[model samples]
Target: MYYIAHRLFAAHDRALAAQLAHHLALKVGEHQVFLPFCDTDEEDLVADIKGRRLFELDRERLRSIRALIAILHGPSPDDGVCMEIGYAAALGAPVILLTTDFQDYSSAPAGPRTVFPDPLLDALATRIVRVPRLGAPAQQPGTSRFANFAARNHAQVQNATEACVEAALQLPLPLPTISVPIRDGSTVYAEPSSYTAPNYALPGRTTIAGVTVLGPTRFEAAEPIPAARHDWAAALSSTRIVVDGSGPETPPGAALLIGAACATGRPVAAYLPRSTYTHATGREPNHRNLMVQYGLEATLRSADEVTAWISG
Candidate 1:
């Protein structure tokens, strides 16, 4: 049986610790939770109260424990739970550090911060290689205190779920627009508004130094290349930046483009739309070709929007 030693006892209040342990116990079957009582243990005659000083638990005995769930409460030297968590981490035991605050911790590298019972249980199930199970605790609805607690925890879980779903959705639809480079003294014709076409004219005599210049814009005559570039960069500065995979370095020179947009005061919105690019294309060349063309069209339309925003 897998054990989840309650390294949270020292950090949480007695009531809160008891609540957490009860909830955790419900999630994981046949688990052990250690609660150290220095004064009480000394006064009482409980031989099972294991600790280095209390029951003289050594490294070998501690190694026998399976996992450690560290609860990061406020700074307190009496927090024996934190120390136990550190020891467990040093022993290479699976450690899940729980914290409500975002304060910096020099002792242990931060892990996921979770509050909802479902998420906390899910984390444990993932680490301990246990079967997944999520169920709300049974309670009488007439009680105000229980209802209030459930309402708060339910909202927290819902918010976490929404955030996860949003992140998953953002992975495929990156950028959603691209700027068309228009330089000084360049004749630009706007493209007719179509389902998959940009509003800006294609590249004529101007180019934005390093980036690829897409053709066929249906917008106003082009301005100076540097000025257009700066304007486009300015618009992207505040947009959120999303990357598909940081493992494989971003496409060559792509980093520079993103970096330039981010260097400005605004947040650059960038995502690896390539993931969904292939999805947009089907087995037939007609649809695949159309998708590719539409991507270019969207890029042009984006440029028009940015230019308009910049000019505005």
Candidate 2:
């Protein structure tokens, strides 16, 4: 049985939460869910003593949960949801974040300006289920109607719920440990060097499993600038080969690393599983561009391909 955690602040959120709970219960065949505001009424003010008690209760509930599913709706997630994510992570629980905001909110936009999930949430999530915006009003005449709205909303909720359940089922797995540079929108120049020979193996014979940028670093609300840069340098220096997991939306830090690798004659590879490529870039990967611009030695399509490259 899985214990799903979610927020239920507004009317629509409550309704969606109920639907999600029902769907998840059906999918798991005997599961418990924590929907905040389901049992308690919203209050504008509460006594300090009572508030403390409520906080304790919420934490207790959070502790018992096996998985956490945070519903994010805008450019930023709710403060409560962020706290919940931190709590769940501290407890070593897998977190699945469902969000409709899928746009790159960075200063330097990577790809299309479509709605994208928050970078920090994407980094922390055990799985991220990106769903369409619920209740998007039809624009044309004869297109907007009560029936159509109801049907569309119901379908969106159902699809998102199913995705959440699938993510929940895959829980309790170890999170991937990757190192990549963080892009800070700084200018990085490629240096010419004589070390043109490729170095894919480290002194101790270590190979990079994958490379991913520190997304949270770009958000001032997420981490401090100094720390984020420190992490980026650490990730780059520690690995033999740096894998580009950022797709075409390469962060400045990752791009810097690519140039550094080229200057030092270290091999850099691109890894884009079909699902990831489609979800991130919303189209087929431009392999030729990645190889030419980034000095990438190869564009890998799967874990097996990456493994082969590492082995060879």
Candidate 3:
């Protein structure tokens, strides 16, 4: 069985949802599910159906399908799909809706009695014969080198300024205090106080070449400061090492900088936001979930927070 979620939201969120749908489609395809997005036009829909048949899930080739699972995260009205799920139920095809929000649709009468908790599992278990588990697990191929590399670098590939600082500090080399020179004046690593006169150094701070002022930090016109700062981090790499700004969140450009550095086999670190890294070693999963999921432990496995947590 195939299911599609109608994506109706802002551009960025919609794009992310599409990616999520693609991942879901791949999972469903493994079980021979034939889900085509309803939002697609006639041309795309037809092409999708044919593509699924030739490459992965062949709806026409499969004799029977269990059910179509529609994932719903919100309580917005799905007036368009009320009739469709109803039709599926009438045809003896199971219609399941998964929603995080509580919504009562009994009066609306959409489809076959809506199941709770896990509609997809419920439909498959009750409405259709479950696909039997294989006796022996299939041998999966080893992880590719590029994938392993990315996995190790993702935490340090943070798309936020805070992450850039965190990643830099974790580097084996001592991080330089960054400074940015503005058109009218100069700013120290995107920090205002760094530009102050007299010694041009903050109290208890001294500027050292290649160890301070690590930046040509630029900011979006409307934004207050550069999202991230980068220094020529070459000493560690025998080339110009780009230091990402640690004050603000990382901008899109900063992520590319980090990615390029990692690609060259050079050590890359991002200054993760304190909020993001505070729970890196907590017993419960924190913001590091995605980082860990992507195999980015090397980038995130710093001793600073772990030591602090232990001492505290």
Which numbered prediction scores highest in TM-score against the true structure? 2
TM-score of each: 0.29, 0.49, 0.24
lDDT at residue 249 of model 1 (Cα atoms): 25
Over the stretch 100-124, how does candidate 1's per-residue lDDT look in tens digits?
4323322113433323211212222
List ranges where model 2 is wrong by over 4 Å: 1-7, 29-31, 39-48, 110-118, 133-146, 172-216, 219-312
Q: List the global CA lDDT of all models.
A: 0.31, 0.49, 0.29
Worst 10 residues of 3 by lDDT: 185-194
lDDT of 3 by residue, 98-197 (tens): 3333332221244333222212122221122111122232233697766655553332222221222222223332222322221111112211111112
Q: Which portions of model 3 show Cα errors greater than 4 Å?
A: 7-20, 26-65, 73-75, 102-312
Whole-model lDDT, model 1 = 0.31
At residue 204, give the lDDT of candidate 2: 33
